[model samples]
Target: MNIRFDGKRALVTGAGKGIGRDVVKKLVECGAETIALSRTQSDLDSLKQECPSIIPVLCDLADSESISTALKDCGPIDLLVNNAAIAICESFFDANTADFDKTFDINVKATIVVSQIVAKGMIERKAGGSIVNVSSQASLRGLKNHLIYAASKAAVDSVTRTMSLELGPHNIRTNAVNPTVTNTAMAKVGWSDPVKVKAMTSLIPLGRFAEVSEVVSVILFLLSDFSSMVSGSCVPIDGGCVAS
Candidate 1:
């Protein structure tokens, strides 16, 4: 199926690097007017250089006020990608309040807040929109040292389902993408050891981790008209890891 987002406006958080960066680039290529939010100005500058059509916004997801201020003048966005997240790997017994708070603030709370703000605009304009939350496979299955991170993402999945029910009346769709260990710099640090890679890959039916583009493809699909009836779902981009 040919999916095109011509004339649509999309906003992606954590758009400075990794999956977010790839999503922004792909959105632009698909003819969408993209607004990218990132904490680093240099990364935004590099993104702008690569895709001149994208509008960059500097925002820290951890702060509630920052999210509101950054999106204040972003105009009406038809697609929202809540992709900003941080993983503080600590065992359940050892995880502290600070780590839990920080993880939830960015991964869960910020996603809800951003979607609320953007959805308000969409409702006001009478133009229904699509929202995709970037969650993790750990949310569905237990992972070592991912206690807090997994919990935060599980909350994200809940938010997706709840929002879909509330927003469906307004013709707004909400969903989440749960990807397994992706080939990104941040993830590479954890899976760098050959033993770790083999152990993890062996469990995946596909016998490989996902590439950033693979995740982006699913994000774009959900955002496009191709997934008009899809909502309140957690689409796994795990290369068959969930299946295994």
Candidate 2:
């Protein structure tokens, strides 16, 4: 079966690289008029240079004002992927107020801001929309030095459920994709240790890390009409890691 979004519109955050970049490209391929939001001008430039059809909005996730200004005039979105986040590694012993504040400000607050604005548009249009929040397997089960990141994602999961309950009446759907340590640029930083990687992957039933495409595929399904009945669900894109 072929899935298409020939006339739909989509907005993706953290569309600079990795999962977000792939999602933007795939949406364009599937015929959605896609908007790519990134804090980095260079990443946006390269993405635009490559796709040529994406609407690029440069706004820092940490700055709510900038995000508001950037999206104030954007046409109503049919799908939204809240993929922008920062992972600050801090164990329980060393967790600080600064790291926690910064983590929640972007991961939790930014997701809420974007979803609220787009949801209002959807409600007014009465056309409905799908929201896919990029949560993490870390939120389901803890790991070493993931205190702030896990807390923020867990908060996002709550946001997703609340959005589903409130927005479902308007035909809007809200869900999240919780992925394990994927082989992305973000993974290269803390996951470079083979010993750590081995320990984590062993827990997964599939015995391997997640891939960028794997996560994006699930996000697309959730964003599309194919998942018309799926809402308030935290779908794991892990290699069955969460279940194990």
Candidate 3:
């Protein structure tokens, strides 16, 4: 299928690196007027330089005020990907309120904040849109040091469902993409040890983690008209890790 977004506008958070960075590039290639949001100016500058026409917004997703102010003039986004997230690896016993608050603020709360800001315009224009929340496979099942991270993602899934239900009437769709340890900077942080990586990979039927393109493909599909009927779903691009 020739998926295109010639005249549409898309906004992606965490566009500084990894999966989020790749998703923005793909959107630009697909003909969308894309906006890349990142807390780091260098990441946005390089992305804009690479994509030329891409708009770059600088905002730290952890701050609700920053998110709101940065995106207030986004102007009727047709697609949004709440891909900004951070993971503080603390075992259940070791986790604290500080880490918990930080995780939820970005992974769960920022997703809601950005979606709400963008969705209001969609509702006003009566134009509808799509939102993809970048959750994690850790959300499905517990992990050793993923206590707070897992909880935040579980909340993201809940957000996806509720938004889909409420926004469906307005022709808006919301979904979550849960990916296993992809070869990204974040993966390096959590899956750095060879022993841990080996142990983790062994559980997946594919015997491997995912690539950025693999996850980006699914995100773009959901953002496009191709996934018109697929909403309120937690789709896993985990190489069957979740299934296995």
Q: Candidate 1 residues 1-244, lDDT tens each? A: 7878898999999999899999999999999999999999999999999999999999999998888888999999999999999988788798999999999999999999999999999999999999999999989888887899999999999999999999999999999999999988769656788987899899899999999989999999999999999999999988788887
Tell me the tens digit of each residue's lDDT in model 3 across 1-244.
7789999999999999999999999999999999899999999888888899888999998889888789877777999999999988888899999898988998999999899999999999999999999998988967898899999999999999999999999999999999998999998878999999999989888999999999999999999899999999999887787877
lDDT of 2: 0.93
Each model's lDDT comes to: 0.93, 0.93, 0.92
Q: Candidate 2, clashing residue pairs?
A: none
* Worst ten in a row by lDDT for model 2: 182-191
TM-scores of all models? 0.98, 0.98, 0.98
Give the per-residue lDDT of model 2 (tens digit) for 112-204. 999989999999999999999999998899788898899999999999999999999999999999999998888886799899999998999
Pick the winner on lDDT between candidates 1 and 3: 1
- Candidate 1 residue pairs that clash: none
Residue 135, model 2: Cα distance from true site in angstroms: 0.2
For all candidates, the clash counts are: 0, 0, 0
Per-residue lDDT for 219 in model 1?
Answer: 96
